[model samples]
Each structure stands twice: as structure tokens, then as C-alpha cells.
Target: MMTNILIVDDDIHILNLLTIHLSKDGYQVFQAKDGVEALDLLQEKSCQLAVVDVMMPYLDGFELTKKIREQYNIPVILLTAKNQIEDKEQGYAAGTDDYLVKPFEPKELSFRIKALLRRYDSRADDSVVRIGHTTIDKKSYEVQTGSRTILLPLKEFELLYFLMSNPLQVFSRDRLIEQVWGFDFSGDERTVDVHIKRIRERFSTLTDDFQIKTVRGVGYSLEAKRS
Candidate 1:
């Protein structure tokens, strides 16, 4: 199947440039002027990935990313003009799978897109991981325990899924950040703690089959309690 890519940006030059390059690379490109138009396009077409610009008239990239996370299981790459750490943090917190500063090489964007697509594709092949009665479905980006289904934000879900996949293996904050957020992540170790805390809070009352154990001065591990 040919890969479908959606590029959301208000800049006509960027749209045309990316469209030309991505098409040359054998990808089917979809263009939208803003988040509103992006969502409208999404409703009618199925895209494997999205590249969103930060600055838009009707809706911004962060907001669009959040909405896409809520409704779709595809990966998102956020494009921004600012190279500030805070803006990168905001983009990650908003659920972007990758980030690129503007005036970037189209080849670099292609490389990142290919990497993300491979990651998502590999996970989708055998995406379901389980501990005791709890289940994490990477394909659907959801968690289930008994009859209760939990929908976590993209980062939180990815964090939990990573830990559960390697149950009983300790991983440091840096490792988790690299594996989950990618090597380019600029956030501090505290970001891992925050996501781990949220995952614990979310699943604390949901199950007894497993628990995320913190190793002092080391890192964390998901230990299976029952099975």
C-alpha cells in the first residue's frame, strides 16, 4: 500500500515543496491550510502520518495534534519555526510523535517520517501486550482491564506500554525518554517521572495484576504481581 501523508500548514510554499518532494519519494500527499481543514480532510481520507505546522490561522499544530491523538492512531510530526526548548516541550506534551524546526531539509523530514512509520508499523504487527488481566493495545492505543477500557493520552500510553512490554526489567529515565520520546527529546529526566506518576494515578485503582515499581536512584520497572 502506498503511504498517505497529510501536511498541514498555512504556508503555500511549504505545502508545495513538501508535496513535490514527498510525491517524488513515492508518498501520496494531502495538504490542508489549517487544523480545521486538516480535520475535515481526515474525516474523508485515511492517512498513515501527519506533518503539522505550528502557526496556522484557524487552529494551531498543538491543538490539531491533540485532536488527532483523541481520534486517530497515526503518528504526527510537528513543524515549528521556533527552536526553543519550551516550544518543543509543548509540542511533545500536545502528543506530537516527532518535531522539526522550520527551514529544515526535506530529506531530514523524510527520514523522520520513515522512522516513525517503521516504528508504528512494527508495533502494529503484534501490538497487544498483557500483564495479568490488564491489556495494552498499541494498534488502538488503548488499555483494558476486565470490562473497563482506558484511553490515555499518547505519551502516557506509550510510556505505560513500554514498561509493561519489558516487565521486571529496570530502565532509567534517560533510557525511557530515548525509547519512548526519541533521541532528540530535549526534556529533562523529570519528564519521565511526571508521565510515570500519571500512569500510576490512572491505573492505581484499575487493577491488581501489576504495579510500576520505582528503583531508588535507578529507574522503574513493571512487576507482575499475579501472573
Candidate 2:
């Protein structure tokens, strides 16, 4: 399968430049004009990684990075002109996996993308997590219960895997958003609610051995169904 990369920037020149270079390097590239459009694209499609610019309308790079982290496990590289240490610190705080200053060499950007993707893939390949009857194959992005296996969207899969990893341990919405999504996630806590609801629906008719519990004032937990 071809790797999909999303590039967000207001500059038409930068978008064209990256599209040409990344396509040549054998990547399927998607372009977005700003953070809002980037988020929409993410929801509509899955990309292996994102390269975003800082100064954009509607949503800036930092905020966009946070939102991406909250859902996807993919790497995010922030491309910007601000080279200050403080700026880089803020970018990391916003859940960016890497940072590249503007006027960057196309070769350098491509190399960083390759490195981040390899690192993330390695981590996934070595891990297999299970809860109740559901087995999460992190490497293949799948959930299996008995003989029925289902492929999940990126956010839903990550959310389920996180909760199942620590079965019965309650994670508040804020913490879930921070830990499962990304520490830099700045969106509404309700985003967690939406994903959790989706997981419940997916397993509703499929299994009775496990379920997600709402801790009311706290958050949610995955646990074996009570007989």
C-alpha cells in the first residue's frame, strides 16, 4: 500500500513543491490549505503522517497538531519559519513528533519523514495488547473477537487499544484526551465521548464479554461484563 501524507500550508508554492518532491519519493500526498481543512481531511481519510505549517487561518499548526495527536498515532512534523527554542518547545508541547524550520531542504524533509515513520512502525510491530476476548493487533491495526475480526478507523482503534491496555482503570476524559489522543490535545473533551460511543456501538452486537464503563464524573474504563 502507498503511504499517505498530508501537507498543510497556506502557501501555494510550498504545497506544490512538497507534492512534487514527496510524490517523486513514492508517497501519496494530500494537500490542505489550513488547519480546519487538514482536520477535515484527516477525518475523511487516513494518512501515515502529516507535515503542517504554523501560521494558518482558522487553526494554527500547534492547535492542529494537538487535535491530530488526540486521535491518530501517526507522526506530525511542524514546518515553520520560527526557529526559536521557545517556539520549538511549544511545538513539542502541542504533540508534534518533529519540527523543521522553513527554507528546509526537500531531501531533509523527506529523510525526517522516513525516519519518523520507521520508528513508529517498529514500536507497533513489537506490541500486541488484549482485553477480554478482543485482541488488538497493533501491527496490522485490527481488533479480533473470536472468529470475527474488524478493522477500525485510526482514532477508534487507538482509543480502544488504550482503554483495553489498562483494563478496569478509569481514565478521565481529560486524561484520555491527553494520553490517548495527545498531551497537547486542545479540543473539547467531548471528542473522547464520541470515540468511546463508537467503540461501544462496534462491539454491541459482536460481543458480550467486554464493555466500556462510564465513570460519570471521571471517564471510561474497559472491563469484563458482569454475569
Candidate 3:
């Protein structure tokens, strides 16, 4: 199946540029001028991935991303000129999958989109894994804390889902490095910390043991469900 992608940006040039390039790669492209419109379209129709801009009119990308986390596990890439570490943090905190600093190449954007879509596809499964109050339905790309839902971005949700599926299993950061981010990733274990912190923060209100635990000298593990 041809993958669907939604590009939400206020800049006509960026939108047009990305759409043109993505379509050539055989993605079913959808466009939105701002966050609100992007969301209305999302409610109406779904996409496999979304590319959002930071400085939109009515709703900013950050706000839109937080809202998107509420319902969808679709990958989102933030397109913006803001390159500061703080700005990237805000985007990641809001649950953006990837960040593209402005003045980027259309080819680069195409590559990033492809990477995200492939990552999403590799983790596809319907098996549901539960740990405490949290339940992850992999097939549906759904995350739940009992009945209350905690909105998570694509990477964070996938990270949590994998760990939960293999509870109480000690995985070295290197092993997690291999599975969660894939062997193609050359980054250090620090990337693991970032995603783990995000998961724990979201489930902080749900349960104490819903936490992803740090094993002191070892790596990490999700607490298993109590039957």
C-alpha cells in the first residue's frame, strides 16, 4: 500500500516543496495550512505520518502535536527554523518524532519521512502488552493506562510498548539501542534515556510502578502486570 503523509505548515514554499518531493516518492500526500485545519483533517481522515511547522497561525505545531498525541500514534516531523536545543526539547516534549531545522533540503525531508514511515512499519503488530495500569495495543498503535489514555508521540510509544512486552527482562542499553532505535542507528545510549524519561513522565499520574525502572548498574525494564 502507498503510505499516506500529511504536511502541515504555514509556509507555502515549504509545503509545496515537501509535497512535490514526497509525492514523487509515491506517498499519498495531504496538506494543511495550520494546526487546526491539520487536526480537522486528521479527524476526518488518517495519515501514516505528518510533517508539521512550528510557527503556524491559530494553533502552533507544539500545541497541535500535544493534541495529536491524544488520539493518534502517527509519526510527526517538526519543520521549523528554530534550531535551539530548547526548541527541540519543546517539540520532543510535545511528542514530535523528528525535527527538521529550516533551510533543509527537500531530499533530506524525503529521507526523514521515509525513515519514520519505515520505523512505524517495522513495529507493527496487534499484540497487546500490559504493565500495571498501562496497556499497549501494538496492532492499533494505541496506549492506555487502564481506561485513561496518556498521549505519547510515535517513538516514545514504541519504546514503551517494546519494554512492556518483555517485562522484568533486563535489557542493556546496548540491546535497547539495537532493538528500539534499530541497528542502523549510530547514536549512543543517551538517546535511550530521553525516550525513557518521556514514558515515565506520561505515566507518572497513572501508577508508581507504571514507571520504567532504572536497574542501577544495569539498564532498564518495565514492571510487569500483577495478576
Error of 1 at 135 (Å): 11
**lDDT per residue (tens digit) for residues 1-227 in model 2:** 99999999999999999999999999999999999999999999889999999999999999999899877889999998978999897897787889999999999999999999998886666567765576887788989998998999998998887777667888778767777666656789989999999999989999887889999887898887665
Pairs that collide in candidate 1 are none
TM-score of 1: 0.65
Best by TM-score: 1
Model 3, stretches more than 4 Å misplaced?
126-161, 164-227
- List clashing residue pairs in candidate 2: 69-181, 70-181
lDDT at 9 for candidate 3? 90
Model 2 poorest 10 in a row by lDDT: 123-132
Clash count for each candidate, listed in order shown: 0, 2, 2
Write candidate 1's Cα lDDT for 1-227 as tens digits.
Answer: 99999999999999999999999999999999999999999999999999999999989999999899778889999999999999998898777899999899999999999999998987677689988888999889989998999999999999989888878998888778867887578889999999999988888887888889999998999999964
Sort the candidates on TM-score, descending order: 1, 3, 2
Clashes of 1: 0
Residue 88, model 2, lDDT: 94
Off by over 4 Å in 2: 128-177, 180-227
- Give candidate 1 regions above 4 Å deviation: 128-162, 166-211, 215-227
lDDT of 3 at 122: 61
Q: Is candidate 1 or candidate 3 better by TM-score?
A: 1
Q: What is the lDDT of residue 212 in candidate 3?
A: 74
